[model samples]
Target: MFRHAFRRFPLRVFGLVALAFVMANILGGLIGTALAATIGLAVFLPLFLFKILMVLMFFRFLMSFVGGYGPRRPCSRGRIKDRLQEPPAEPTKEETEWREHVRLARKELDELFPDAEQFIE
Candidate 1:
């Protein structure tokens, strides 16, 4: 649906709508707070929260259309073969050393405080 619009209409419309949505929410929140204080906080709080939530959802929707601010690329279909073709990344020396240190510490802890393990469980 959006892809069709992107093809037909200028992309600027989407950007403008997103910006307007954000500005409206900000102004609405400020006005709502003033109204709530004069009338009652209870009514204003929910309205404020709702407007904020709507703005957040609108921003997320806009981000999806914006391609995360990068060059848009067509998505590719995939299978397990694609995953298998990529080699696994190797662990760094620091990571290996950290794991070994943890193992040794655990071993020492087990010997030094068997009761500690029982308490943890």
Candidate 2:
């Protein structure tokens, strides 16, 4: 289903995001508390906001990458798999005959024309 569509690339990305989220939340809390005690609320507030943004972004990115669980199927209107799998059309018999005729005509012209030196004008 989604397993074939997504592959392992997105799963690896989700794992990395989750790791970053954990690290940021833990470190940001510790660092934010210390900075507030020393530098005050003005600087600490921005740092806190930045940490919150990072957490939210990481979760959003992770969820978007996660694969769906279900049977594999295309849209209701048409089968995407069939559309992708279809082979290109081969030339029709008429087209093939036309190409062959053109080749024979070119050969005949070359024989008749021979060389420019052989021609009078």
Candidate 3:
């Protein structure tokens, strides 16, 4: 769908949006070239680092959010202590059998090549 729009109405969709966004800053009437420089830097740096497509999509999502800022939330909600404090679960029967097989393989490997780094344990 977007590929089609990119082929079709680029100016109607993104081109004019970008143009208007830049021009709005240019014509904000007070900031002058400072705002223009900031806008130019934002565009050029993101294009250089992350490439044009990702930067454009980021700007599109930014424009979609109210006042161009999403709602704030904590970076992470969970307490690491909770998980660390929990006891590990017992291994299942299948896991036990798998471990036995691994142990046997390691034993064989040790017998065959004692100098090996021994990965199984």
Question: Clash totals for all models, in order?
Answer: 0, 0, 0
What C-alpha RMSD separates each model from the true structure? 26.2, 29.2, 22.8
- Alpha-carbon deviation at 48 in model 1, angstroms: 29
**Global lDDT of each model?**
0.78, 0.78, 0.74
Ranking by TM-score: 1, 3, 2
TM-score of model 1 (CA atoms): 0.35
Query: What are the models' TM-scores?
Result: 0.35, 0.25, 0.31
Off by over 4 Å in 1: 1-63, 66-69, 72-85
lDDT of 1 by residue, 31-96 (tens): 998887878767778899999999988876676565342234222224345666889879999999
| Best model number under TM-score | 1
Q: Decide which is better by lDDT, 1 or 3.
A: 1
Q: In model 1, which residue pairs have backbone atoms overlapping below 3 Å?
A: none
Displacement of residue 55 (Cα, Å) in model 3 is: 17
Q: In candidate 1, where is summed lDDT lowest over 10 consecutive residues?
A: 69-78
Q: Over the full model, what C-alpha lDDT does candidate 1 score relative to the true structure?
A: 0.78
